[model samples]
Target: MLSKKIKKLLNRQVNAEFYASNIYLQMCAWAEAEGLDGAAEFFRGHSLEEREHMDKIFNYMAECGAPVTIEEIPKPPSEYDNLMEVLKAAFKHEKKVTAMIKQIAKTAFEKEDYTTFNFIEWFIAEQHEEEVLFGKVLGKAEMLGFTGEPGQTLHIMDSYLKRLAAAH
Candidate 1:
């Protein structure tokens, strides 16, 4: 059984994941509108991944005998100045998610909720990968100066993103 505090935190995390998925979806739409097909595909795939993450937490909570509270998700912004801006926003959001996961893990440990703590271990590792993945992409975007425009640089970066998405 999950402690009330832990259950509440898990529910919050589930909502956060949902919000992240929507944000990614919005980014995908922006990328598509800008004609960055590769980036659009990548964001679209990531949006689904984020939904999976939310579902995983929801299932875990249910398995632990805690019924999740479904809450309202705020609308995500649809406008982005450019692809670089979109990547930067995504990287920033990932960092925020990583912090939230760490906080949940820390609270679980402090409360001696080993089951919850153990359950969160996978999320810890996932957040690490998420941050690293976003950071790597952001770094490459910075290096390439990807401006969401039609040019050789955009093609190169788009191809790179397509390959990156495929590799995962």
Candidate 2:
């Protein structure tokens, strides 16, 4: 059983995960429109992963005997100046999510909710991977300046996305 406060917080987290999915999908659309097919595919895959994250939390809530409620997700930006800009935004978003997870973990610890704390350990590990992945993308984009052939960048991005897709 979850305390009322923790339950409410978990519900909010569930909604945030949904919002994350929506935002990534929006990014994918923008990337597709801008002719960055590789980036677009990468974001599309990310959107699917985000949905899985949301379901994970939702299922956890149900398992804990807490009612899961979803809220409306806000619209995400439909365009970016370049691939680097998009990757940078992704890194920032992941950092923010990491902070949110930390807050939840802290609260769980304060309340002595060991089960919730243990559950959140997965997120903590996930955030590290998320940050590193985005950081690498950003780094690659930086190394390959805007003046380079767009096709090459697209190929590189596609390769990364393909690797990710093959993982699951």
Candidate 3:
């Protein structure tokens, strides 16, 4: 059973995750409009993954006998200056997610909710992978230089997105 406070927090997280999905979807749209098809596809896929993450928590809440309440998701930003700017924003967002997950884990530990803590372990691992993946992309963008040929950048991003899509 989850404590009432924890249950509320988890439900809030569910909404936050939904917001994340929407945010990524908006970014994907912006990428497509900017002619970065690979980035668009990548963000589109990521939005799906975010929905899965939200569902995971929602399911957990239900299984634990807690009521899951979903709130409205806020609108996400629709425009970005360039691919690099969008990617940097993505990296920052992932970092924020990692921090949020850690805070949840800390709370679970403090409350002696071993089951919840264990459950959150999966998210911790997931966030680590997310961070690493975004970090690698950021590193590549840096190497390629933000001012590089847009076509070359798109090709490279397409290759990476293909790999990620295949992995999924």
Candidate 4:
């Protein structure tokens, strides 16, 4: 059986994941509107991935005999100043999520919930990769200066992102 504290935290994670999905979906919408198809596809994919994350925790809670409560997710912003702005927002969100998951991992360790700990280890690694991935995208956006210009470097970056998105 899971402790109330642990179960509560897990339920909160499910809610957080839902919020993340909404955030990514909003980002995807903005990317599409701004003509960043590659970035749009990337975010679109991540939105689904975040929902999967929520489902994973929900299932884990059931497996642990914990009652699950799905909470209401707040709306995320649908606008950004530019591609750079979008990238910054996403990278910041990823870092925040990494911190959140770290805390959950710590609680799992302290509670000796090895099954939970082991399950969250996957999230820990995934967060790291997510941060790194966003960092790389931010770096590219910074390099290109996305100054609302129509240019070769920007096109190259889009193509790169397309290939990157295709891989995932």
Candidate 5:
């Protein structure tokens, strides 16, 4: 059986994951509108990944016999000033998620809820990879100069992102 507090935390995390999916999808749309198809595809794939993340938690809660409460998905930012801003936002969101996971893990451990803590280990590792990936993207965007329309840097980045998307 799960504690009431952990149940609340997991439910909140579920909502956050859903919001992340929308965030990535919204960013994908913005990238497409800016003529960055590769980036858009990358974000599209990322959005699906977020949904999977949510499902993992939802299923885990169900298995634990805890009521999984899902909240309404919040609207994410639909526009960005530039590619840099978009990348930064992605990293920021991921970082926020990492913090949330860490805090919850701490609570889980304090409660001696090893099952919940063990389940969250995957999220902890995933968040590390996400942060590193997004950080690299931000660095690449800065190197390519993200202010204007399509350029050489964007072309290269598009190809790279396309490959990255294809890998998953």
Candidate 6:
């Protein structure tokens, strides 16, 4: 059984995941509109992954007999200055999520909720991976020389992202 505080935290995390999904979806739309197909696809896949993350927590709450409340997600920005900007935003969001997950893990430890702590361990590791992936993508984009102009360099970056998405 999850303690009341842990249950509340889990519910908040569920909403956060959903919000992250929407943010990615918005970024995908922006990429698509700018004809950055690879970036669009990458963001779309990440959006789906965020939904999976939310579902994982929801299912865990169900298994633990904790009722969850689904809250309305705020609208995410639909416009980005460039691909680099989008990647930077995503990397920042991932960092925020990592902090939140770490806080939950700390709370679980403090409360002696070993079961929840074990479950959240997966998220802690996942957040690390998420941060690394976004950071790598952002670094690669910078190395590709994104000048916010529609040109060969940008096209190459988009193609690279498509390949990355395919492997993902």
Instruction: List clash counts for every candidate, in order.
Output: 0, 0, 0, 0, 0, 0
TM-score of 5: 0.93
The C-alpha lDDT values of all candidates are 0.89, 0.81, 0.83, 0.86, 0.88, 0.91
Which residue window of length 10 is worst by lDDT in model 1? 141-150
Off by more than 4 A, model 4: 146-151
- What's the residue-level lDDT of 49 in candidate 2? 87
Poorest stretch of ten by lDDT in candidate 5? 145-154
Name the best candidate (by lDDT).
6
Clashing pairs for model 6 are none
Residue by residue across 8-106, what tens digits does model 6's lDDT show?
999999999999999999999999999889999999999999999999999999999999999988999887888877888899999999998998999
Residue 47, model 1: Cα distance from true site in angstroms = 0.5
User: Which digits, one per residue and each the tens of the lDDT, describe model 5 over residues 11-110?
Assistant: 9999999999999999999999988898899999999999999999999999999888778888899978766677778899999999999988998999
Best by TM-score: 6
Clashing residue pairs in candidate 5, if any? none
Error of 3 at 138 (Å): 0.4
Regions of model 1 farther than 4 Å from truth: 147-150
Instruction: Rate residue 149 of model 3 by lDDT.
Output: 47
Superposition error at 27 for model 2 (Å)? 0.9
Stretches > 4 Å off in candidate 3:
147-151
- Candidate 4, 49-74: lDDT as tens digits: 99999999999898888888887789
Error of 4 at 155 (Å): 3.0
- The TM-score of predicted model 1 comes to 0.95
